[model samples]
Target: MSEQIETWGDLVERAGVGIGGTPSDAPVTKLISAPIPITGSDGTKDFGGCGSGCGCMPQA
Candidate 1:
């Protein structure tokens, strides 16, 4: 089962795409959503960052 699962590094290495420290080379828009600040009823402010994950393309 482990073999069936491919990680981001594996895919990038297989595709020969250099994984730079930045997301400039990404084919897809890495920005899933803009930073959103939410205010609760208690007057507390919360900021949400990008969703968690490697943001890599799925294997075909």
Candidate 2:
């Protein structure tokens, strides 16, 4: 006989589709602050201005 599914969590559990990481194993403490530099490149790009000739302007 087939198993009965009551909720989405039950369906996912029955399918056995997961990476095997529980809530307790989550990297909650590994989070970083906004001031942390992710890359070596300094975000100081001066895009002059978004004039009609600017290619960066969204075409709408």
Candidate 3:
């Protein structure tokens, strides 16, 4: 039998999905606020690691 999941709750209810193993009360904000320094002066200082021109950055 095949089933479609439309929401996070639906996916969590399914078995073998490892939903119960995850902590429900985990902190919402676990991201590190520190800026990662990029070494090597290859004239790549303008390339913002994970922002702007970088593909890792979130697009507005």
lDDT winner between 1 and 3, please give it.
3
Candidate 2 worst ten-residue window by lDDT: 27-36
Residue 4, candidate 2: C-alpha displacement in angstroms: 1.1
lDDT per residue for candidate 2 within 1-60, as digits (tens), equals 345555445555667876354542333232223333323345644433345644443334
Q: Which 10-residue window of candidate 3 scores lowest in summed lDDT?
A: 25-34
Q: How many residue pairs clash in each candidate?
A: 0, 0, 0
lDDT of each: 0.44, 0.44, 0.47
Over all chains combined, what TM-score does candidate 3 have? 0.23
Q: TM-score for model 2?
A: 0.25
Q: Per-residue lDDT tens digits of candidate 1, residues 1-60?
A: 233313555546666897667444334323454233344446655423234442332222
Give Cα distance to truth, residue 42, candidate 3, Å: 18
Top lDDT: which candidate number? 3
